[model samples]
Target: MSESGKTNPMDEQTPDAVTEADILIGRIVDGEADEQDRTDFERLADADPLLWRAVATRHQDMASLCDEVDHEIAMATTLELPDFVAPRRAPRWAVALSGWAAVLILAVIWTTMPQSKGIEGLPPARPVQINPDDELTFEQHMQQYLLAPYVMGELDPIVFRVEELPDGRQAIHYVRRIEAFEFLDADEELPVNDKGHLTIDPSELHAPVGPASIAETVH
Candidate 1:
C-alpha cells in the first residue's frame, strides 16, 4: 500500500488499518484521503508513473478488500450468533451457591436475634436441683411448751424416726421430742414401784414354762 515509496505513519493506532502505506495508497484514484494526505498524494502522483500504478493497484486491492469486508459486515449485521449459546445453562452446582447464600443469611439472623426464651417460653429457671437426701434439713420445728401452768401430765416421750446414721448405728432423726413436767399431781404411777413388786414378778410369772425352761429345770 506504499505510494511513491513514502510511508504514512498514522494508521497504526486503529487495529483494522495498521499501515501508513495503506493510507497513502488509499488517497489516490478515489480522492478520499485526508487534507494532509491529499496534498502528499498529489505530489507523489504528479512526479512518478510507477507511483501512480502502484497507488492504482493499492486502491484496487483496497476496493476489493472493502467489498469483501462489506460482505462480511452485511452478514454480521443480518445474522445472529446463535443467541450466545446461553452460557451452557450455568451448571447445577453453580446455581446451588444461592442456596448456600440463603443458609448464611439465615444463620446470621439466628445469631443476631434476641434469645430471652426458647421457641416457646423457656422452662422456669431451675434454681437448684435440691437433692433432698442430705439428711432432711428441717427449717422449723414446733413443739408444745411443756412447762406451762396446768398442762403437765404423764406424757410419754415422743419417738423419732431412726434414720440411717453415718456411723451405721442408725441415729434418730429427732423428728419429735417431748418431755414430762412436774405441774400436775399424779394419783397413780406407772408401776407399784420401780423395785420388783410382786404383782407378777419374773420369778412367779412364767410363760407356762417353755420346753427349754422345763428341760433346764430337769437338768
Candidate 2:
C-alpha cells in the first residue's frame, strides 16, 4: 500500500515491470537519469532493498576501473621535445640602423659620465666650444651633434616617395638619396627633380627655427 490509499502499481504490474526497473537502474548507475526519472525510480524502489545494493555495486565497479586507468597513465614516461633554433636575420639597412643606435648610446654615456679622480697621469681635457647664453649642457650638445647626421638627410631609409594616383592607387616616386656632402653645396628650389631623382638643397640643411619658448629660458 502506498501513501495515496491505492495498491502499489509495481505489485500488480506484469513481468515487463522488472525490465523497466532494470533500465531505470542502469540510467541511475551511469549518472544519466533526468529529475523525473530519478523521482519515479526512488518512489518505485522505496520498498526494494535489492535494487539499492545493485546500484552500489555498479558505482564500486566504475570507481575501480577509473583508479586502474589513472595508475596506468601515471606509470607512463614523459614525452621528449625537440631543440628549437631561430630562422630569420635582419635586413642590411636594419642592421646599419641598429649599429647607429648603439653608437648614439655609447656617445651619450661617454659625454654625460663623470671623470674618475682615482686614475693617475691622464692628459688634460680639451676645451669645448659652446654658446655663453645657450641653455643646453655639454652632454646635450654632444647628443645633438651625434644626431645631426640623421637630421642632415644622410641616413634616410625611405629611398622613394609614395604618390597616390588619380585612380585611387599608390605609385612609388623612385628618388635617389641626397648625400650629405652634396646637400651642403647645392642651391635648389626643391630636393627632388622632375624625374623624381633627389637634388641637393642647401636651404633645408639647417635645423628648423621658430619663436623663442619657455624651453629656451635658463633656470
Candidate 3:
C-alpha cells in the first residue's frame, strides 16, 4: 500500500519473495531460481510487459546466448541454462566470457548436426557406363560357324562358346579347329584383370574335357 492506505498494483505479490524486476533479472540474467521463484517470475512477466522486455534486453546483452530451449527443461544437462538445439554464431568474445556454457552449446550442436570429420580422405567415385547397343554376347556368335556342317551326320554335336573364358580352348570358327570343353571346380573362380576373359562356371560342367576332336590345334 505504498506505506499508506492506497491500493498498489504490486501489493498482490509476495512481499518478501522477490520484486518483478528482481525475478526477471534472476530468471533471465543470472538464471537462479527455485520452483516458487520461477512461478513468481512467470506471474510477474504475465502481469508486466516492462518486466519481460527488461529480461529480453539483459539476455541479448549476451548475444547468441539467447537460444531455443528444449521442450522439457529436464532434458538440459546443465539445468537452468537453456538447451541450444541449433548453435548460433557470434563474435568469440560473446561466448568466450560465458565459460563452459558456450562449450556445452557447441558440443550439442556438433552432435546433432551432420558434419564430416575426414572429408578430404574421400574422393567421389567415377561412374561406369556401358553402351549396350554395340555389345555382343558370346551366345550370339555361336551359330555362325560352330554348327556349320562340313560333313552332315559324320559325328556332330552342339557347341558352346568359350571365348569369354580364359582357360577356354580356341575358336571353332577358325580353320577346322575343334574346341575342347572342360569343367571348373568350386574354388576355380580365378580373379582376372579383364573379367570378360574369365567366364568359366564355378560349378562343374555337364561333361568333362577329354581330347580336342580334330587333332592338333590349328593356331
Best by lDDT: 2
- C-alpha lDDT of candidate 2 relative to the true structure: 0.42
Instruction: Give the clashing pairs for model 1.
Output: 8-20
Model 1 scores a C-alpha lDDT of: 0.37
Total clashes in model 2, counting residue pairs 3 or more apart in sequence or in different chains: 0
- Per-residue accuracy of model 3 over 126-148 as CA lDDT, tens digit each: 23242333332222212222332
User: Residue by residue across 23-126, what tens digits does model 1's lDDT show?
Assistant: 56655546777878867756766765466677777678878998999887875654333312124553222221111011100111222224411212212222
Which residue runs of candidate 2 sit more than 4 Å off their true CA positions? 1-18, 75-219
TM-score, cand. 2 vs. native? 0.26
| TM-score of structure candidate 3 | 0.20
Runs of candidate 1 exceeding 4 Å displacement: 1-22, 27-32, 80-219
Residue 213 error, candidate 3, Å: 89
The lDDT values for all models are 0.37, 0.42, 0.36
- Give the higher-TM-score candidate: 1 or 2: 2
Of the two candidates 1 and 3, the one with more favorable TM-score, higher being better, is 1
